[model samples]
Target: MNVSNLCVLTVTVICMVLAWSEPSKACGSCTCSNGVVMSCPNIVQISLRSSGLTNLSGSAFQNNKIVTNIDLYGNQLVHLPAGLFKATTKLQTLNLRYNLLVDLPDGLFKATTELQTLDLDDNPLVHLPAELFNATTKLENLYLSRVQLDYLPAGLFDAITRIKVMYFWGNKFDHLHAGLFKATTELESLYFVRNQLVDLPDGLFKATTKLETLDLKENQLVHLPVGLFNATTKLRKL
Candidate 1:
């Protein structure tokens, strides 16, 4: 081929490549007043901390298929539209701390089965639906500190058996039901500090045999049940 023709072909190819590779549509806020949709095909992480967002539209995450991490900390989100994360199947880390969320839709994390770390601290979550964590089998760390969690349904953690670290500090629960951690036998570090627990049922920690560190400080425990920690032989700190 002639040199002039080759140069022209190269330029044409470069232009075609650039046209196909549009810039990512990642936005740092969801307070869209003009009905703008948030869709970014190639973005891997999104950080929208302290954006003053009060609500998220249902399609907030639609078409954002490849995102793996999302941080929405310190927002005023009171309710998340249903299926907000339905398309974010590749999500792994989600931090929603310091939001005004009181309840989350059932199966909110269903599409995020690969989620490993989830932080819901400082939300006024009164009810955590059963099976909410059913799809997050790979979850390793779960933070619920400073959330007004009064009770948890049975089998709440039945599917997240791979959890390694958990924090439930500064809640309003007065008692822990038996077999609550039956499926979390692989759990390592547990924090229940600054809660209102008065007592734990016998064999409460039976399934957490691999427990290494347990923090139960700042509770109203009048007495600990006998043999509660007998099964947790590897427990180093209490």
Candidate 2:
């Protein structure tokens, strides 16, 4: 073969070998027989949402370490096994909406430091472990609507300084503790609608100076604290 032809042939062989060594991205890595996973692929995203799963096998994500997104919405899961996400540190988005979870184990999210968005809406969770979100410093959007939360532990949000949008609608909160959002200075939108709150502390929004939208509709407020919006000069909606 000529030198030019020999160079082309060598390049083709190298390309083929590299392609075969890379993990498949053609589809999700799961082998489901009658709606059950018999084998899982080690890929970047895994979606088994609405699969009627009441429980997950402990080995569901056994050897898959590079996952970035997981969708577990509309399942019947009452609990997640501890360390379920320990190996998936690169995970960025997790959807757990419409589940039956009442509580999460302490430090459940300690390893998902790269997480950005988390949806836990429409669950029966009445409370969260203190500092459960401390490790997710990069989180930006959080959805906790209709989760039956009545109160939050002090400093619960101190670690999530990058949070921008948060949902707290349809809960049973009658009061909000002071400085609940002191660390969310970059927050833009906040939803507290349909709760049982009767009063708001003065300057409750002093830290959220960049807030643009605040929803207090359907609450039980009789009067607002003096100068409640003094710090939120940019607010455009109520």
lDDT of each: 0.80, 0.78
Residues 49-159 of candidate 2: C-alpha lDDT, one tens digit per residue: 675666654445544467788888887888877677877788999999999999888877889999999999999998898789999999999999999999888888899
Residues 1-238, model 1: lDDT tens digits: 2223322332333334334554232132222222433343445666667766777766656655887888889988887766889998999999999999999999788889889999999999999988899999999999999999989888899999999999999999898889899999899999999988999999889999999999999999998878888899999998
Worst lDDT run of 10 residues, candidate 1, spans 25-34
Q: How many backbone clashes does candidate 1 have?
A: 0
Candidate 2 clashing pairs?
Answer: 29-41
Off by over 4 Å in 1: 1-39
Q: Name the lDDT of candidate 1.
A: 0.80
In candidate 2, which residue ranges exceed 4 Å CA deviation?
Answer: 1-42
